[model samples]
Target chain A: GEEVAQTPKHLVRGEGQKAKLYCAPIKGHSYVFWYQQVLKNEFKFLISFQNENVFDETGMPKERFSAKCLPNSPCSLEIQATKLEDSAVYFCASSPPHFVAKNIQYFGAGTRLSVL
Target chain B: SQQGEEDPQALSIQEGENATMNCSYKTSINNLQWYRQNSGRGLVHLILIRSNEREKHSGRLRVTLDTSKKSSSLLITASRAADTASYFCATDISGNTPLVFGKGTRLSVIA
Candidate 1:
């Protein structure tokens, strides 16, 4: 069984400030994904990383959101100049290289972002 | 946008009963997955059925896929009070766009 862990269960930030969330994938997993759940409803794709390289960022808001999966440190998704609409629960999920389709996915509890 | 849409936005059932949720997608997929989210928490992957497969099972959970219909369904038998949660279907649309999820079915299982 694999586990994906996210930090800072809740966050509060001003509208113009920056928000950064962290995720730690399982010990051997290679792919890390970030998704935003607005008001605990629809999940909006953000970005995904395969190891240290970003594989797909089409869903990410290039101007405001960015993510990094550096070695040693846990993966991170940062939003610069956060807005009111950015208030949502950001989930971090990880899957093994070949398991994205069939292998069981592991998700962290999530980080609730509140932009005032 | 190849989003998975779920049927019966909400459902209510009693304990020891079976809970079934259906999901329909817009396009072809490499595989379709079902996930469970408890309240405000993140999603927990329940099962993943490949495109070529018709049915899959894990414990009391059952998942069936129909490529022609572009649909899937998840069945949980002997439901319990703790099974009350939002069940969602996420489709792996054979690309790098990440998994697209449905609106989910809010299930309330009464004891």
Candidate 2:
């Protein structure tokens, strides 16, 4: 695939319930990143992966948020015990190897999560 | 945390008019890139300017980066109604890290 693909265009979860989102990065892309956007404002980086290894997790909340990228499978982000503050659009992006000259990232349509 | 802040927050212009947006960052960067997002859509890459490059042009879009001031500006020439979207400036600090995005500028091109 030439573009990143995200599953469940919209997801609704009750407070304290678990929510999961999925993303399939572009074919051959080695870097995958997740970001959260609230109120259509600035994007908050959640996590990033280089191939199947975690490249950066500093922006992720360790308590209830977890993510994984395994070979031959789409990456996943799961939130346990969702809160109202967790309501936002989750975007997944993929970029080619960092060694490439440009650092451009291709984004998915995003999953809009609503915590009731 | 966001490192870039966009100016004006929002803007409106008649079709065919040029629109410009500014962004300022708090730290040095390896490159600055612009992205456009239509309502409820994925972001579209606009242009990217390296730290050493001062300006770049692609079709109707022009990007200028001033490393000394840690600021960048995007200009859209002859805007169209379909061009109405939020514009964001993202900075790559080390080229390998995730980009830090700004709040973004909402531009409405009225037909």
Point to the candidate with the largest TM-score. Answer: 2
Residue A50, candidate 2: C-alpha displacement in angstroms: 0.5
What does candidate 1's lDDT look like per residue over A59-100, in tens digits?
888698899999999999999999999999999888777734
Clashing pairs in 1: none
Residues B1-111 of candidate 2 have per-residue lDDT tens digits of 899999889999999999999999999899899999999988889999999999999999999999999999999999999999999999997765899999999999999
Q: For residue A9, what is the lDDT in candidate 2?
A: 98
RMSD of each: 1.9, 0.8
Q: Alpha-carbon error at A114 in model 1, in Å?
A: 0.4
Which ten contiguous residues of candidate 2 chain B have the minimum total lDDT?
B91-100
**Two-chain DockQ for model 2:** 0.85
